[model samples]
Each structure stands twice: as C-alpha cells, then as structure tokens.
Target: MRRHTDERAHVLVLHGGQQHSTEPTSWRQLSVLRSRLFAAAVARAGRQDRIGVSFLRYAQRGWNDGAPLRDATWALARVREEHPGIPVGLLGYSMGGRTALHLAGEVDALVTAAAWVEQADLPAVHPPTSGRALLLHGTEDQMTSPEGTLRAAERLREQGAEVDVRTDLADTHGMMRHRADWHRLAGAHLVQTLRTSTCDAGGRGAD
Candidate 1:
C-alpha cells in the first residue's frame, strides 16, 4: 500500500465470494472496479486528495461461516491505527456487502452493492448512529433477492440512519448493467457523507 503524506479518508473495498484459496491476490478485479469508481468519483468532485483506497483480501473465499466479518474488522482496525483521526468507509459487493452492512457503525460511510443481506441476520444489527449508507440492488438479481436489500434498508432507516436504496431495473446479481451508475452514486454518496461528517466534527476531516 502506498502511504500518503497527509491525512485522507480511507475507503476499504471488499470483494465477494470466490473459489477458496490459500494464496489469494491482495486485490481482485471486482474490488479494482469498485476502487477505481470511487477514486474517479472523488476526483470528479475535486476531493481526490482527501481520500485513499485499500482492499481487504480474505484468507479463504467462501465467506467462511461469517469469518469474513473478523477479517473485515481487523482491516478496519488497521486503517484506524495507520490513519488515526481520519474517516474510513467500507464498500463491499455481494457477500462482502453483507459484511460491510454488519460493520457499518464502525466506519464513517457505508456502501453495499448487490448485497446478500436476507440471510445475514441483519435484523439484529443496529443502524449506524453517525454515518450514512448507500445500498444498491438489481431488480433482476436471481442470486440475491433485491427485496431483501430493500427490507434491510427500511430497517436501517427506521433506526434513524441516513440510508439510500437504489434499484436497477435491468440488472442481475452481478450488476453488469448500469455499472457506471452504481459507481457514480456510491462514490458521490461517500464523498458527500464524509464531508457532512467533517463539518459535524468542526472540519477536522472525515473518512
């Protein structure tokens, strides 16, 4: 990871399930897409200098009976340790989106794409108290139910968190269609949310 000279909000991109592997690459193609989109969004907003991106590679790729949550937690801790006082965001896809939603309270902003939240025990999770969330789902997603994502979003909203749920009518679980729209919405949400947090913190900065 390249170290930045100045403090910047850090966004950690998490990938979905893959064939189990002991020697996985630190970053995957999906994660790369997410990171690039987020970076581009920030750049377009003229806030690229205030944000940094990273990836979390799992030791094994099956979601591991929720073990990925531990990995995600550790990654967030490391970000806090290395970039103390800066804001941090979590962006996950599919299984990774479930993990991001689970740990939403720990980060400054949360974004999930085609998240598998129905079976993730999301009803028991509390909404973030001081952060914003963006949940995206495909209406035609056969692998994961878009209804599940919408339900979760409603729950989060009822709990007093700022939540935005978007549905793509012409996409599937992979969200191959409307990829640009996903990136733009998510990236803009992250930047805007972090900016709000910064203002709330007296302009110190936010994740």
Candidate 2:
C-alpha cells in the first residue's frame, strides 16, 4: 500500500464509506475533506512543525465487514516500523470512525466523527488502553445513533481507557454545522496525547 510520508509526527486519516470503487475519483472529495480537517487542526494547535498528515484509502470503498480494520492494523504496523518511536494519531469519519476505534490500541491518539460504533461487534474486540480517544457526535444526527456513540464511550471508560465524548446539539451526523469546533477539539487532543506520550517515554527512559 502507498502512503504520503514526511518528517513530522504522523496523523493517519480514514474517510467515510463509499461503494466499492476502482476509480480514484470516487474518494477524492472525502480524502480532501479529511486531509484539510487534519491540517486545520494541526495549524490550530501550533503543531505544524510537529505533525504531518496522511490519508489512508482502503482497497474497497465499503467497510467490507472488518476488512478495513485489518487494513488499518497493517497500516499502523507500517507506520510503527517506519517511524519507530515517533507519535502517530488516527482520525476517522463515519464508518471510518468505527474502524479507528477498533484499532485504537495501535496509535497514540484517536479522534472520531459520528462513529458508527453501535453497530460494531464490541464483544469480539478489545477496548484501547495504551492511548486516549475523543468521540464527537451530533445530537441530531440522522444517519447514526448518538446514544450508540455514548454507549461505546462508556464501554471504553469501563475498560480503563481515557475517552472524552463531546456532543454538538446543533450539528448532524456529518458535523458540518460547527466544523471549526470539531477541528479545534480534535487538534488539541492529538497534540496533547502525543506530547503526553513523549513525556511518559522520556520519564521511563530516565529511570
């Protein structure tokens, strides 16, 4: 699999669903939107010097019944192999959000927008413990259940994972109504978590 690489801390973004497509044009819009959001967040957090963004495209446009999760795991392995000790974050929208949550153990931080987590097979998957996660959902989302998102957050919390759930009353499943808020929150979380991890690693090494 091909990826965009740079010297700064890496942020891997996964876009929402599209019908399985062989053409690149089908995912162009979502890819652009996810990339811009990550860039905006990094800029807002003054992490332009610390963060580099990459958009991950799945072989299939659909979630593919857990295939995307496996793809994400492979991608994370690749990132860890190439970057070694560097910080890495995962951000996902809609179906991609569910995939990110599933693979949260592999990254330093996670940010999900309207994650379709209620439908995820939670019993078979383990919650994240190594990193923190931010879950953003709208109260009026028509496509996915907000209650479901909250429930997933609760489960993560129960599993001793650091999870923050934010609700936008005026937004929808797409969260376009208050896009800036999403960027600001996500960017801050990414920066904080990565920095915290670095500090913890340094402390351990000093011992």
Which candidate achieves the best lDDT against the true structure? 1
Query: Candidate 1 on 1-207: residue-level lDDT in tens?
Result: 224567457778777774244445455456445444544554454255466677777776676568778998999899998888777777788878888888887778888888877644676655653646888998888877788788878878878887888985579876767877887887788777766665666554343
For model 2, give the 10-residue run with minimal summed lDDT: 1-10
Q: What is the lDDT of every predicted structure here?
A: 0.72, 0.70
Candidate 2 global CA lDDT score: 0.70
In model 1, what is the error at residue 84, expressed in angstroms?
A: 0.4
TM-score of each: 0.83, 0.83
List residue ranges in candidate 2 displaced over 4 A.
1-8, 18-25, 30-36, 43-49, 124-131
Question: In candidate 2, how many Å is residue 35 off?
Answer: 5.8
TM-score between candidate 1 and the true structure: 0.83
Residue 1's lDDT within candidate 2 is 16
